[model samples]
Every structure is written in structure tokens, then in C-alpha cells.
Target: MESNILVIYTGGTIGMIQDPATEALTPFNFDALYKHIPILQNFNCRIDSYCFDPLIDSSNMNPSFWIKLAKV
Candidate 1:
């Protein structure tokens, strides 16, 4: 059977990348996810991602965030 994995990106250091031009860290655009993480292509199962709008910081997570996460 095929497996399905949902990668929930809640915005944190894990999704930050350094801008080569300015040397400043910025949020990575999930649209180019494969380019940044080629290893994902090796996975046999189907992998999908869901990024929270406005990207919540880990330090700022609250009950509302948990509710939203649970609904997903």
C-alpha cells in the first residue's frame, strides 16, 4: 500500500534559508521545495506539505494554533 505523509510547516528556523545576495536569513518558498531538499524525491510514498498562513513562530504558538493543527 502507498503511504501518505503530511508535512505541516508552522514557520520556524527549520524553514529559513540564507539569501546569497544579502546574506540575510529568510523564509524559504515552499514552491521550490524539491530544489532545496532533493532527498525527498527518494521517498516512495506521496508527501504533501501544508504551510500555515502568516507562518506562526514556535515561541508564539498558543491554544488556537493547537486547535487549528488538530483540525488538520
Candidate 2:
């Protein structure tokens, strides 16, 4: 059976990459993420994400956000 997998990244370090030019860590572009990690394309499932417009700090997470995710 095929399953839809939702990978939620709350702007944590796990979802960032080091920009060699600027020596800074930036959010991975979910749209182009597969290009960077080609192995993901081999998966048999559909992968999707819901990201913040501007990454938010984990400490600032609010209930409204959870509610929004639940609706998705």
C-alpha cells in the first residue's frame, strides 16, 4: 500500500544546511530538497512538508501552530 508521509520541520538544526559561502546554516528548501538528497527520490511513498514562512524559534511555538498542523 502507498502511504503519504508528512515530514514536519519546525526550523530545527536538523533541517538546515551549512552555507559554505556565508558560513551560515540556512533552512533547506523543501522544493529543491530532493535535488540535494537524491536518495529520497527512491522512496516508494509520497513525501511532503509544511514549513514556516520565516523559521520560528522552538521556544516561541504556540498552540495555534499545532492546531494548524492538525488541520493539514
Candidate 3:
């Protein structure tokens, strides 16, 4: 059976890379994450991602955000 994976990108240092010019560790674009980690292609699974707009600080997460995630 093929498993499915959902990568939820909120905001933090999980899969971030430093922008050499600005020296900022910004979040990697989830839509193009496969380009960075090609090994995902070999897996018997579906990989999808969801990004939070206006990116939350995680610490500021409220009940509505939790509800959105639960619905996913």
C-alpha cells in the first residue's frame, strides 16, 4: 500500500535554509521541496504540503489555527 504524507509548514527552523544575501533562515518553499529532497520520489507514497499564510509564530497559534489543521 502507498502511504501518504502531509508536511505542514507553520514557521520555525524545521526545514529552513539561510539566505546568504540577507543571512536569514527562511522557510523552504514546500511546493518545490521535492527539488531539494529528491529521495522522496523513490517512496511509495504521496507527498503534499500546506503552508500557513502570514506565517504564524507557532507561539501565537490560536484555536482557529488548530481547527484548520484538524480539518486537514
Q: RMSD, each candidate, Å? A: 1.4, 1.7, 1.6
Per model, state how many residue pairs clash: 0, 0, 0
At residue 35, candidate 3 shows an lDDT of: 95
Off by over 4 Å in 2: none
Off by over 4 Å in 3: none
Model 2 weakest lDDT span, ten residues long: 49-58
TM-score to true structure, per model: 0.83, 0.78, 0.81
User: What would the per-residue lDDT of candidate 2 be over residues 15-38, giving only the tens digit for each residue?
Assistant: 898898998998988877688888
By lDDT rank, best first, the candidates go: 1, 3, 2
Model 1: colliding residue pairs: none
Displacement of the residue 64 alpha carbon in candidate 3, Å? 2.3
lDDT of 2: 0.81
As for candidate 3, its clashing pairs are none
Order of quality (TM-score) = 1, 3, 2
Q: State the C-alpha lDDT per candidate.
A: 0.87, 0.81, 0.84
